[model samples]
Target: MKETPSANKSPPKDDPRIDALIRGYAHLSEQVEVLTEQVKIQKHQVDDLTVDAILAEFHQKQERKTHADSPTPYGRTPPEPAEKEEAPKHLQPEKPHRKRQGLKLAGNIVFYSALVFLIISALFIRTTSNGSPRSLAGFTGMVVLSGSMQAEIPKGSLVIAQQVDPKTLQIGDDITFMANPTTTVTHRIIGIIEDYEDTGQRAFQTQGIMNDEPDAQPVPAVNVVGKVIFHSEVLGQIAGFMGQYWLFILFAAAVVIGLTVILKRIYQKEPKQTAH
Candidate 1:
């Protein structure tokens, strides 16, 4: 047979072809590593661009919302805030009822004030007697038990008397005085006896308007109580009536006050109960 190359030749250790093949493989691997690094860099760049775009879009949306919420310019009115919804009628307070309650309270106050006034007036008028007449604010209240003065100061009249100086008392002036230790009398001063009984004190000669003769005793200056100022028959009747029924009136007043307190408490709690 002719000489031929062996089918599986063992290449030499210094073969240029094998060296070139190994060098090419190392260069290809380096190029592949470089391409992978470039792909990673490009991916990072794309991610950053996407994040910036999203951030920009979000900022734009926020700005649009803020602009919409801002007030409008001069020509246009700003949007009004929504009104708070009212509660249902069943849950709402009764205004008319409250108004009625207020009126009732005012009426009660007026009524109580009048009642108190009448009570005080009655007490002042009824308690003043011949034995011990009381004076208040320089004025004495007296209930006339006789018709001595007849037309001027009738029987059963409430008389208001003002204290005056004995020197100021004049003839023809109606006066009240202590006639005795335990008796009081109202009469007219007809004359003044200066230096009566040599006591150096002046005295008044007094007599009833309807009497024919003057009183036997002279009214000394010290016995003079006051000058009669005013008198009223209607007030005397009312005073007499109140004197008899004052205890009953006081009891009724207490009952009314208690009821008012209870009603006020109920009125105050009604709104709280409705709210709950």
Candidate 2:
């Protein structure tokens, strides 16, 4: 049968429904990308604000305490007792100051004792651990004297290195050893360069970052102290701030206590019943 021309007509060149659907999808995808970037920036700003608030609160409290303990602002002295109306000197006592001093001494003792106990426990565990020796011969602390290893190891970092035989060290292994008795160095082993010396013994050299040239001389196995075993981020800060300001430790302790209390309260709270 032959169909009519109207029946054989094609669909419209532009359908409004199809165009609307395509536009909707493109708008949704663009909105999602923009929202994701916004969320990242907001999270970073929140973290920075939180730290700033905490530090500011701590300093403000400290300043208030300092002002309270200070003398009168006007420096006006209290009237002295008249000679005939004098009160007995023995009646007054320095009890308040003595009590405060005693409390401070006790708090300091407790704080130091706790810190020492923690340090001792850590040291004991390290000494008893496997693959670690107790002797200083193969284990010692090395002060970073140069910035050659600035990325991996910065200057002033106390590295605990273990003395290892040169034959045992492999390429890509990070190690610290004495290039000479007077000087020690820590660097990654890029490769082992061996050469026969006049004495017919194998001489080894060490290379490090930021050095335009290889080590001036070979490092003897005997000069090695040990490889780094552990590192503490706080230890360096504490060492650097020794006898300068002790209040930071107290602030840290307070923050920890507050967080612990908050967690406990949250965990102990009863769940609310949802109405049906």
Candidate 3:
């Protein structure tokens, strides 16, 4: 008797091509998952940094309040005179020793110099890269003031902007202009309304992606600054932090960079000669 079709059927043999395709698909899926996770992590990090920067800026603008959390300083807050009380004989007061402060002062000076140098270096790099002159050319770096751009350019991020000829700009390009008469704004030029270019001065208007209304009035071309080309979350955070207590931040950063350089030099200079 012949074997029935059902009995004759066996499991299909695995093909090399089919196996390879399956493995490839699995690998691609894993890669996509990993990339997704990395993106999520980076976004979260940027958000946290931005928040910290904003808070730091706010604190700097406001004066420190004297409260339960704040300790009173110096003779500003006079201590109440103690009522007539007997001095404890068991608690003998010891003579105060003169503290050696010169070493610390010297160390602080070196640290401060290093920090200043690092900041200057960073600023120079930024200026050179952004096409801004290093002197007092009325050019300044602006932090992404708001989150209108969101994912493309989040708030609390630093951007280098230089004043430029507005006539050189084209549609769909990002530009910075004054929004109200008082506030400076940075936004993409969605459209350009050509108007009379009287006296070689062209007026341009600006709008934000997240905004419904166009800017109240057109800004003069002179108000247009250089285009933003660079942005960094780290820089934004640092700027925000420094905005609060600039002196403290400057001093701290200098000390950190100075120590780092000194340590690096020491490590590199150590001889690697073999011991007998």
lDDT, model 2: 0.61
Of the two candidates 1 and 2, the one with more favorable TM-score, higher being better, is 1
TM of each candidate vs. truth: 0.54, 0.36, 0.43
Arrange candidates by lDDT, descending.
Answer: 1, 3, 2
276 in model 1: Cα distance from truth in Å?
16
Local accuracy of candidate 2 as per-residue lDDT tens digits, 130-214: 4332344446543455778767777766566666666777766667665644455777666565544554343446677767686
Candidate with best lDDT: 1
Worst 10 residues of 2 by lDDT: 124-133
Taking all chains together, the TM-score of candidate 1 against the true structure is 0.54
Candidate 1 segments exceeding 4 Å error: 1-110, 126-130, 245-248, 254-258, 272-276
Model 1 agreement with the true structure over 63-141: per-residue lDDT tens digits:
6667568866788655545467999999998799889999989998898897786667655654455565667787877
Model 3 regions lying over 4 Å from their true place: 1-139, 180-182, 193-197, 257-276
Each prediction's Cα lDDT score? 0.84, 0.61, 0.66
Q: How does candidate 2 fare on TM-score?
A: 0.36
Q: Write the residue-wise lDDT of candidate 3 on 1-276 in tens digits.
A: 886578667657775787888999999999999999999999999999999999998875453332323566666663443356766867755434413466656877987676664465345333233443332254556567787766667887766666666777777666766554455577777666556355556666666777787667776776676666677777777766555556665577767777878997998999999989
Q: What local lDDT does model 1 show for residue 264? A: 82
